[model samples]
Target: MHSQYKSRQGHTTLGNTKTTVAAPSWISDFKEITKMRLSISVVFSSLVGYLLGVDVIDFKILGLLALGGYFMVGASNGFNQIIEKDLDALMERTKNRPVPSGRMSVNTAFIISSIFTVLGIIILYSINKQTAMFGAISIFLYTCAYTPLKTKTPLAVFVGAIPGAIPFMLGWVAATDDFGIEPGTLFALQFFWQFPHFWAIGWFLYEDYKKAGFFMLPTGKQDKGTAVQTIMYTIWTILISIIPVFGFTGTLQLSIVAAILVFAVGIWMLYYAIRLFKLMSVKAARQLMIVSVSYITLVQIIYVVDKFIR
Candidate 1:
């Protein structure tokens, strides 16, 4: 489902000497390896972190984080591809990745990943040591631990959430130069959200992932246990999203109205998760995916609005 390939237009006529005018395979290969959508989503979180953290919005620092975070995330993904090349080949969705498709050499991919990782860390270091450290830790955990553990256990999603949530926290640290309630709050927000988001994807692509030997769900099979757990996490996500309303999480305070709005969105998302638990159908998973996406975007927007309003 991930690596989608479409056939070219009409076949050449017999005796036609026209060669297909296509770009270099390497160009396509890079795109496949980078996974543009995923890299963009990762960088979006980094940008959100930067926006939330900076008291005085500095476009220059924001630019640096965006570019640097992209490379950092891309590097992690590239290395992940290399590690999972074998398994990826087994999955229809992943079989066309750069390494798996033979469009890029493994050495080439590794070199590119190394360059990006080093450059990303250096750029983050310019912002602050904490930012750089978090970036480094994210890449390390994602690549060294989470990537390899995918096939072994579903708990890997839990482990993966640690690195996954770092971008938002990284933003706060970049601005404050220290980790505190603000960064902790942002971290918690993203941390809990990942569970439902990923589980939805896992549910939708359960068959595809299983083909690749990935145990992405807690129950391995898409069952009530897994769906109920997904619903529980979504409930937790909703609870954490509105916690700032209680006026206890330092400067990040959400008003009653904002909390209610956020809670409504959470409940909306949880509806699908609960449905998935009860019906255990792909339709429920699809609905949850839509709701999960809406949940994250709305939650972040609410956070930004609450910060200015409250």
Candidate 2:
């Protein structure tokens, strides 16, 4: 009987040991740390630029551009997290992030970020010198300048928009190795789009941002002034988005039909921005945010489709 009990005890102990040895979920943790969804969205913008610029659509170059864009954005995000870990811990939305939540050490995060930065620059460099240079600049501006500036002043949004706009133009540069009116137009579209999108986020997350002392909204409050600025920038975004149809953007020309479609979408976005100005409520801001995202995505789709159809 005692021998039988010893065998059962051994089995239970083995089961306990097996249960205690949990496997590391490095992939999921890495995704959270790098903000994979946001990185993917940025990569999509670069791919859109590449698709618009490339004549023959080389899948190999396209793949490299997407990969390089993701790595660069990922590295920027990781570095941003490391620098803002303490501040992030104070914010409800960011408190659960890998660095702030103690799921990942800063040293490990830094090492991973370094690897991503090196790989990203090399991948972009393989495409072209200009692409690599812009990739590096995007990372530098995002991590070094925009990340810290969030707490200092609302103007960080403008600074942040520089790197934010780079991906859209980077694809064009990757394809042509040139920065001309075409890429400039792409940069301008994205640069203006960020204001409304970011301000909408700032409006709704005012309290959360306040927890960490981040002054994201213009006027540093969700007042009529901020809403008015959001409206003004939305108008600017709409105006510039249709300028390609006027034939000034060279190879980046848009058909009149595409221009009309883009304008319609812009109008839809503007309606929400106007409503936000009138209502000045969180709901209106949220609606504006959703419409703004749809507007950009639809505009990009229209641009690419217009290219192929034409």
The candidate maximizing lDDT is 2
Q: How far does residue 158 in candidate 2 sit from its true spot (Å)?
A: 0.3
Clash pairs (backbone) in predicted model 2? none
Local accuracy by lDDT, each model: 0.84, 0.92
Please give, for residues 51-139, the per-residue lDDT of candidate 1 as tens digits. Answer: 77667888888888888888888889999999999999999888877798776789999999999999999999998898899999999
lDDT of 2 at 70: 91
Q: What number of backbone clashes does candidate 1 have, counting pairs of residues 3 or more apart or in separate chains?
A: 2
Tens-place lDDT digits, model 2, residues 1-310: 2223323432333444663111234555688778998999899999999999989998999999999999999999999999999999998888877789786899999999999999999999999999999999999999999999999999999999999999999999999999999999999999999999999999998999999999999999989999999999999999999999999999999999999999999999999999999999998998899889889999999999999999
Q: Candidate 1: minimum summed lDDT over ten consecutive residues — where?
A: 1-10
